[model samples]
Target: MFQPRQMTKLLIAASKDHIEEVIGELYKRRLFHIEDYVRNEQEEWSGYSIGTSLTQADQISSELVKIRSIINNLEINEEQLPKADYTKQSELSKKIASDLPDIAARIEAILLKRSGLEAEQKDLEQKIETLNPFLAFQHPLEILSGYETISFLAGYGKGTPVLPSESELFTSPVRRGEAFNIVAVRSGQLAECERILLDAQFQKVVIPQEKGLASAAVERYQQQITGLQSEIKAIDQEFETIKKQQQLFFVSSEELLTAEIEQAAAPLRFATTEHAFVIEGFVPTNEAVSLVTSLQKATGDKIEIQELEILDLNEEPPVEFQNSRYAQPTEALIDLYVRPKYTEIDPSLFMAILYPLMFGFILGDVAYGTILLVVSLAARGFVKGSEMGTKLIQILRNCSVSAILFGIAYSEFLGTSLPWHPIWLSRHINMGGSASHGVEYVSHVPELLILSIWVGLFHITLARILGAKNASVMEHGEHRSKLMFAHIGWILVMWGIIIAIWSYFPLLLMPDLTGLPLIAGISSSALFGGILILIGIVFIARDNVLELMELPTIISNVLSYTRLVAVGLSSVAIALVTNYIAITMIIDPALKNFTAISIILLIAGIIVFLLGHTLNTALGLLGGGLHPLRLHYVEFFTKFYRGGGKIYNPFGMIRKYTEAEK
Candidate 1:
């Protein structure tokens, strides 16, 4: 798995010799063939069309058995089955396809009718289920299917009065409409007419408003009426069920049936006469060789297979992109992140080494690192939001080792004295002072930053080298020499320029105008760098004299690494702030006397500890790593890197869902 490898080649051939035997065997095995007439990626297989024979006839036949079970459950007979002829099936499919809207309308009408019946039936059942046998009644309320309008006397009222809707929206005194007649009916007269309402889109209808009660008593009356209103709704539901059964007779089950051999030959019916056999599919790399060989032997030399080699297909112009080598992490790290663009090199390798080192150097607290390591380990398995959480935890876990190492170097152990203190610090401290003087401070953090810059330079250089390699391979004709010279010349210029600037420019910022003259001694180095840059620009721009101006522009772009030092200093400054706050709390006796002060100190200390580390860790990840990646992608890759090459995807069995890759 560690070894890098190139993609394999595909072999293709064409033959027309054993067409009949091939078709027969394919039918017997229930294996289908796919044809894409257009030699491009967007073409779809026409096997889904009606009248096209399914090559997986056996598979479809198996599916038919399931359909038969459903039909049997519904008690549909053979005579009820539509004709299963291949021609008839095709014709029926075409007819269904042609007038789908009309069919939908009919289906909807039937469903509406069924829904009314269902609602009515459900209302009746609920009323029955809610019956209380012990309730007294003057006379039994009889349930009937037909309507009756009868009123002898109003119940529980000394007098009765009626009010009509006379508002502007419904009825205005100025513009009166016809008065509607009304009667109270206890019997179910409307149930028969509701069948017509099924085709109607009346899911909800408003009851006409009547008024004769005081506003304060209306709520009480409504609670009583709501209970009765619920009963009628149940009755509507039952009526709908009966209407649904009648609709099913119109839809044929034949298309849903399994016809094994016929389904397998489905695709063959769509193939053109010019193409004897067509096969389009994916196979896993491991199984590809064996499957291709077996198929060749079975079909004999009369059949031919053609494969498309996508990755090596030289059909497009090349563009530059980041090389994968610099970012590659160990195999142990791959399970944590999304797949990188290039599989040859994992990007995590540089991150895996540098991240922990930076964290440990800045934090340098044994207790903090240990706690982070433990928490990261625990959370890695349980964090569930984004996958990035898992990766972040893994990164923290890796960095914990660096923290331990740096903690040892700094001689810090849970804010206590180390097992050994530096000899130089021993001379400068009184016996009662805190352990800051205990460990010889590595005091070499500035040197470490320098080392980091060197590492960045190396990675960037390597990226340029790969870019040249890409250019050499892609532009192999006469232009190859020019490309090679440009890449080499640019690298030399960048190296010299960086060295000169690093050694001399920092002195310019020093509080000494006298030392600024020392920069002239390195003047020759700058001159060399500028000349090389100019030459590279001229060559890359195809000997155009105007392109020499691009040298200064590109050089400025390459020198954005000053942000590295700026960010590293920020990390150190954050740590100092935390230390100052923590020490100030412990040393001030007046503040220590108050409980609130101690509480504030505790809260602030914890906050700074957690917040500072998180911020530094993020800065380290982005500024330390991503900026270097940007250098590789922009500066180095600009020399030459082709990005449009198609990925090598082999043909294999594809899992639809839930199954893991083989």
Candidate 2:
């Protein structure tokens, strides 16, 4: 655990193949690309590509095709992207990209039929509208023959004088073909004319009648319109079927291309000096040697490798940003629960230590701990799916083993009292006196509080050490001093108190300890030491009086961990209360059945008990999880690490639906 691992950043100049190899290795190491900077020595490169140089140029070409497709299908009133000189060709390129043999054939078939069918259908519809007015025209003969005559007024005029007739009206300047002839009427009079004719060349004509002759011509037009409409419907259905087929063809073709493109583009290629090649990525410190050797052998000594300065030998780097493929299993588990606070802290290492500690202290129930371990091991070993969740589960499983170990010491099982409890329980009992219940005695709760405080002290000390380690890497001497003195001073204070308590208390079962007061005198010494430590912290941080107010803040932060004791006590108390209620229900003689029924009702109340306590436990964990991180991020990170460094990304095919080649 004390061994130091060296970290180094390497920069390499090599042929495209060698660079590709480096990127592939980094990717396998779980180091994701964050950004890429490509330099085109000549103006030949367009968009994200580096001219015609790299093997992955086709990937850029494909993206361009996608951009063009969006431009081509753009809706009216939508903002068009700024037009480059190649708008027309770009649209055409996308169309061709989207083209497929089966779809092209289907589109052709639909277009050939749709064009003629739509035109003919439109003409027929217009003819039907022209004929509809005749449906209102009525014949007087039908009324005389006991049929109800449907008489209607038809209007037509354009700058011609019209004379009214009872049945129809005729306008002046009428042409021969434009004449309105009444089929029949009750009387023929100038007042009876139902149609007005507008003449050609200002010539006027009038017919005195009570009926119109356009009905037969209109009926004949309607018949022809109806026939045309039926034909249009048949053609439309055929077009719809062809369109669906075309859509299927295009969709399937896209799926196939997406699957194949990455595999097809993996070969290495070359270009002239006009395009400067870039190979940038991360490599593990261990793998750096073999990679350098491989590059020398492959390219015959034309490569340049530049190693950047590595920081923070003592501190762990952030899990998300780590380039190591070989992080321990525990660290892998924690990565799922929390993102790293900085690039300097290794999540893997923190998880390795923290998991066991949390389980040992918080759970501390052998039976429950055993269950948790078994469940976790089963999930890790048997379950091959849910890779992320599985990793975290496996870590928790191992951590739970510590709980089992501590539980054996405490001799606890779900808070039930054990008469033959182990040596650990005896030690706690020696420290804090037992509780008596007239006929029986129970465990001590205050002792648990003291135990919790010690656990907190230990954990806090570890965190400070981690902080100091990071401080050394970042070249911040002040932070190193603050963490060093603060943690040691606190530990010294705690040790003095523990010694004083053990020696002074007579029932603690110790040898003659008359000089206990001298040991207790260390309390004053510890206090003075703490003040000095605080002075050192202020000096290193250069905190003003206002910042010193953060002392209260730090105390509040540390005190928040007391909830661990609060939650555990609450869980046990509620369970014990349940037992009391059950005993009352059985013993009450006057209303025994009523009491039993009331207890049954209380069984419904158990849901509230479960949920309320669960919520409390969750709150404790949340506060615990977040506060520690807050200390690390705000208090610790401020001491060292300025994490604004640029991340390394590369040129490659980036798609939402498809994976890219290395």
Candidate 3:
């Protein structure tokens, strides 16, 4: 489509009672794009105000939050869930009212219980570790502590302390890592012994609060830990079961509640009085009547609807692309750069056609194209949710098709000629490739390069024409005419340069155009081209003297297209070299001998061939993808495009897991 869908403004004013039904129809049908209302205080001393959210919006929101919390606690990711079961909205609402609270309470209790049990298990594990170290002492726990007359210290340190001869001291034989010690001293002399232990880098460890041998206590604690582990495992199993059972319900509920909340809050964007409400929005002209009829029917024809032919000078309507299915993928790039304004022409169709041709021209190869097609097909499903990524993949798919078609034309399968002669012209004739194909065709390198320049000329000329049209629409007054003329001047200058090159050096420049009718009519083509160039410069200078500086761009932009030839030739050369090293030098010699050494070389050569081609394929995808986009962005779109349009965000939700009953 050349233009976006035509839109009409609809203003609806109705009694407050009909607002609920009206909102429901608008949301469910997904037609309206609401233009939010902002109240002005000085509007003739107005008493109107912005409407609040609809009744029970708060209730629905609270319940939605609880459902989300439950889903999160259960770690129920929608991606990992099985296919959702379709159910009526009414059924889902009833479940929310009756089923959610009970499920929420039970799940909460289980989580709380699981947390308490896990805490107890952690505490028991610590107790076991503490008691295990004391086993080396071979002492009853009660004897190590709770002494008033005698003070004791139990810890692990770098070395044993040097205590008084009168004090009782003990050290473990296992002293490789750290020494474990127990030392008792009289209460009056405890400080001196503590200092001596501290000096040895002592780290005090607490003795467990228990009685009996350390071994028995450790055994009892381990038993308690085992019990706690069993309870935790059961809780986990229960959670997994709940996740499986309620995954569909959770996903469906979340989507439904989200839609419901949006509808309920739709009133917030409306202008309201004590008894009436006003709604304003845009709808496609084709669908406008249907929307009005549906709303009136839903409200029993109680609402008053007015269609106004009003234009706001300051604000433009939101832009929704009206590209065909084939051209739609180009929207991603347009959005990435900047969306086209409502008044300007959409370039999706232009980009859709040119981008693939440019890409195929640079990376034409049947094998590479087939690989790209296969990869894009396999990845389509995974990127379905990502709109931009999906569009890019689709673009890749389209470009690959172009590449295959061009590869056939160039007589290249991967890096060599096909079994038959090319359907179109071949690129490799001058590179000794004609001998293998046995066609003896002359190389078209110069012709292709000339063709590249011609492509640039046509593309830039089209851009100038589009730019002039856009200037007429977007520009105004004296400046608009001047700007339009500047675009025209560039076009003239580019054509002049091309004609001069053809007249002076026919073979070195473009394919011989001397026999053409236009060239034949001109007595002195060089002089005619110079005159045209001078006139263009004068027109460009009329806008601003600085504009003349850009005159040289006509030359550079045309030469930029020469990359189409240079880059593609480089790719072909690489492929040729890879085949030569792999098949001709390595594999062919190995097969002639048929020995162990030969077989090994053959395998290595095959590896070399695959790796080489793999590298080339990656290079093709990158070069093919980026170069075409660069040519479009840098060389083509810059001439006409000045995108800064707002994206169209329609007021509705896309349902995925549930269906609404009629």
- Across 255-317, the per-residue lDDT of candidate 3 in tens digits comes to 899888998899899999999999888787788899999998999999999987647511456
**Higher-lDDT candidate of 1 and 3:** 3
Per-residue lDDT for 439 in model 1? 31
Candidate 3 at residue 316, lDDT?
59
Across 548-591, the per-residue lDDT of candidate 1 in tens digits comes to 55656445554444444455445445444444445543434425
Judge candidate 2 at residue 600 and give its lDDT: 58
TM-score of 2: 0.50
Give the alpha-carbon lDDT of every model: 0.43, 0.45, 0.83
Give the Å shift of residue 522 in candidate 3: 15
Worst-scoring 10-residue span by lDDT in model 3: 431-440
Model 1's C-alpha root-mean-square deviation from the true structure amounts to: 14.3
- Model 2 spans with C-alpha error above 4 angstroms: 1-10, 14-35, 38-275, 293-351, 370-387, 404-409, 422-440, 476-547, 581-662
Task: Give candidate 3 regions above 4 Å deviation.
Answer: 41-45, 128-138, 149-207, 210-219, 310-315, 422-425, 429-444, 503-524, 544-554
Residue 339 in model 1: shift from native, Å? 9.4
